[model samples]
Target: MDPVTFSPPLYKQRYQFVIDLVKKYKPKKVVDLGCADCTLLWKLKFQTCIEVLAGVDINRAVITDKMYRLSPLPCEYLQPSERPLTIKLYQGSVAEKDPCTLGFDLASCIELIEHLETPVLEKFSEMVFGYMTPAIVIISTPNAEFNRLLPGLNGFRHKDHKFEWTKEEFQNWAQDVCSSYNYTVEFTGVGKGPPGTEDVGFCTQCGVFTRSYQSEGSLTADSCRDTEHSYKPIYNVVYPNLCDGTILRNTVISEVIYWAESIRKNMVECAQEDETVDNHSYQASSKSVPSVSNISQETCSTEEHVLTDTRGDNEAYKEGNTIFIPLAKLFSFSKVQKLCSSLDHLKAILSETSQVELNSDATAMILSAVEDIEEHAEACWDTSCLELGVALAECEEDWDEELCDS
Candidate 1:
């Protein structure tokens, strides 16, 4: 099945909406359900001062170190700052009952529930309301009522989406959940709708549920346990230190950071050994040939030999440089600086593009630009650098492929 790809504009709106809510709520413990690539977590970490951030995705592939590094949101973005973000990653389906043991102040599942079958969604509601009741729950799903706004849009926005609820259907569900859980819910739409359909004109609908004061006391961990809800520790961080792009991409920031570190250490050791050998040779030559005439002849011969071997040594050095200097100037410092600038530009593109409707042509251009960056990063042969590019490129490629599928 083809994967679902979200538009840059939609992503921006979703992020901003969630970010605004986070700012308003000021929840210290945040949980992101279906946090694929943990994209929002990276944003929230910088945008807010959340004490604990947890990401749970059903796709186990995303939990692996390889995918985590290659799945966008670079290591530099997830770095330690003056106000550090303590992040935890888990792999498990949200359909499971009380998937996580820890309590959260706020929970968000953006553009996720539609992908689940109706039955799973029912269980999900139970999991969220009946068992893992947080103080606040925020959800965003595609609005079936607004599919008419999309050009050539058919059936559902994505094939994986089991169903998209109309505004009434969504409101009904929200009201039912709130009533059952003794919570109060509010509604908002994400995208611009037709002029006449202002109230229900959004491409996506959002529901924010805040538990009532009286309900808080009854919704405890002990109460959840009484319901036979057992929390599983299936979610784990195979690689905790996924680089966020603040550090040099060549260092210990990739899936292969350990290997790269070892190779770099060996290279340093080899260079040191070569320096020692050269020093010993110079000392031995000076002691053995004490005569001034001999020294002079020796110096003349060495000069002559160096001049003769210079061209050959250069050719040999160029060939041997890869082995000797893995981190050695594959690309100039200027090039890396330019690449960093280009990445900053790409970030601008992401922000700017989100404000307007995205087309296939624009998507192609964006993907091409990201690929160009990735290609340059790959030349450095640093997994951290290469994977940063890989993540961006993959994100675009997935979008392109999904567009084709659409």
Candidate 2:
């Protein structure tokens, strides 16, 4: 569970820019996404003149009871009645919707997106733009183009990164998210590259999104005004990385591992249940138990077959909506891919072989269900989950006939 080390200059520049943004848009409530170890907030609370600071990260180990017992610091500007700076720390995934009720003025997720897979990244964006809806959101990720400048840099910036995007890919994604959320985006890069490639030279790229909305009670385009600039940075923090040589664990990849383990545990339980049933039947049959040699051989063969079939079934039943074992193990990252593939294959089979005869309304419902499954697969990554698809398909009685004939 070692944390990955980041380039000092890369992080320093990123933090400085974030601090500048805070100073420009002095927000009262500040939140940091993927705030591993809460070190970033520690620096901010100590160095900046912020009224409130909160850090949220998925790492559960660092957020101890002692960490939450933050000591209050003296405030010179306090009106003998005002409380000092308030600090809150949460342990949860940034990719998921934030559980806190309080909204934030500024949210920062520094060098965290690359670690997430595509589906998780989409959810992360939705959480930021749709749920939190902060006035300003700052996100940073490694600029894949700059890897050439670093002589020792290997495949990716970190071992945990699922994929790295070029400048164009990152900008395209940012533009789409901003447009969907009514925000304007500005891009900046950190680190030096070749002299001529200023735009793509930075080892890390950051995007600043400011929310823009139309005037209250006015729907006209002319009435819309940019309001994000009203917020200014209240704090200027400068601190070197001061933690011990502890490598940050990749929560993103660990999530996948945890998922796989859960699936395996369920499969094991299912197998044990089946074995118990078999044992009961054998005992009731009025026959003595098998010899030790026979029992050992039988146990070995059954276990070997179960293990072999579990893996083989996943690969072999790729086109089916149901499988003997957990469907999630069929795909590398998410189950949605497998579901999509199965749906597409089902469509092709129907088109080439036989077709279900249904009324217009029933056909519409079936088609709508297909679309729903696609979106559901993407959001939940539920693999081999075709309950909706099958239910909708069965709405037309002719489907059963057509399927049997095919």
Candidate 3:
């Protein structure tokens, strides 16, 4: 079959969502499940610095063609031009394959769910989540409600699609499936625009499942009470926007954490046995002890508590733990800033010389950090500034007290 072509608007929106998710996870490897023509994989390989991109599909024809095309090149070959992205293609059902064996940080199943049977769907979820343990998984399908909205004359039905679900149905199913495998699900789509907007119509339903946790056990009998009886008009109900690009925020954060952790690990590994003592003596001689005030003691304490909480629970870590230790706590901001500055300086020097050395690890690390910074910055924007408001009020109170004393 010819590859399914998406409308430009729809394809771009979906691609953005996937890119955000990938950046958030910053997975070393990525796989596209049921990748018909492997076009997505090809695009992703060209776009991201992910170590590997594997495309899997059951179609023998696509796989045979891909193999024939790629076989001429060695197993790994550098492009004649400076191409940053790379991908490999495979042939198999997700239900039958292990993504971990293939080494994927993320797996995508765009427009593949509706074609699956329940048992196969369960198997497919298990195969990916159990083995790959990717930080993120993205899936998209047609929104059934939008299909209903289509005139019957549109003839949009596919012979292979066993079922099409409305947003509600898709959300519930995604939640259930993800939860079964200890994953959190977020719903997005081509309609609406983002998560919560006024526009609601036929658009592709997109679901993102992440290996993250939130506080639980808050629900109570009283919480179940529904007092509002009057029905609101459909116009009053705000239709949630589909993926609004923020989906990439999490990917960015994950990448940052990954890079930060990696850098810390490398530094620790390289440190001399007496380096800490030597540094301490040097600081003492200089009479300039580094102050801890720059770091949030509270945040550090919270992270430590979380680590302690997980110490005995190996299963919990495997499930998904988002409680990350901020790099600021582990490393001096001044040192990090200096390092970044030095890197920038080096880049300029390399450009001047026209002799750019490709440090894949360093490049990946920097990209991850950039993504993380962007993700958290966006998150901070979304939250109301109630704490800031309280702080301002307290400042006013202190000012009044100072004036009275004066």
Total backbone collisions for each predicted model: 12, 15, 15
What tens-digit string does per-residue lDDT give for candidate 2 at 1-406?
2222445555777887788888888887788887776656766765454667877766656655345334333232111112235566666666665345135778998988998888999988887887677788899998898776666778997899998889999999999998887899999866666556575557788899998963233222232232211111222211111110110011121233344334444545676799899888877763664543555777888997786678642331211222222323323335334222453332332233211211232211011211222343233322212332243245334544543553
What's the lDDT for all of these models?
A: 0.61, 0.56, 0.52
Which ten contiguous residues of candidate 1 have the minimum total lDDT?
Answer: 362-371
lDDT of 2 at 241: 16
> What global local distance difference test value does model 1 have?
0.61
- Candidate 3, position 70, lDDT: 26
Off by over 4 Å in 2: 1-8, 47-49, 63-70, 73-83, 99-101, 194-199, 214-406
Best candidate, TM-score: 1
Candidate 2, 177: how far from true, in Å?
0.1
After superposition, the stretches of candidate 1 with alpha carbons farther than 4 Å from their true spots are: 1-8, 63-84, 99-101, 194-200, 214-406
Model 2 gets an lDDT of: 0.56
lDDT of 3 by residue, 1-406 (tens): 2223345666667677777777776776787777776556555654445756667777757655544332213212111112223345544677764322334557788888888998998787777765455667899998766554434525345788878887788888877877676898877776443334334544788878887643242222333232221111110001111111221222223233434445544434444445878788777866564764656889999987896786542121111212223233322334333333444532333233211122333221221222344354344433312333354356457656744553
Ten residues in sequence with the least summed lDDT for candidate 3:
233-242
The Cα error of candidate 3 at residue 52, in Å, is 0.5
Tens digits of lDDT, candidate 1, 1-406: 2222345577888988989999998988888898887678767765545867777887766555333432224444443233434566666778776535347888999999998888999999988876678889999998887776566787888988899999899899999998887889989867675456575557889999998864444556576665543332332221223234423233322212233333444555677898899888878888776754645677888987785577432121222233221222221234433433453433333234221122333221111111233343344345444554566566557656744553
- The positional error of residue 328 in candidate 3, measured at the CA in angstroms, is 38
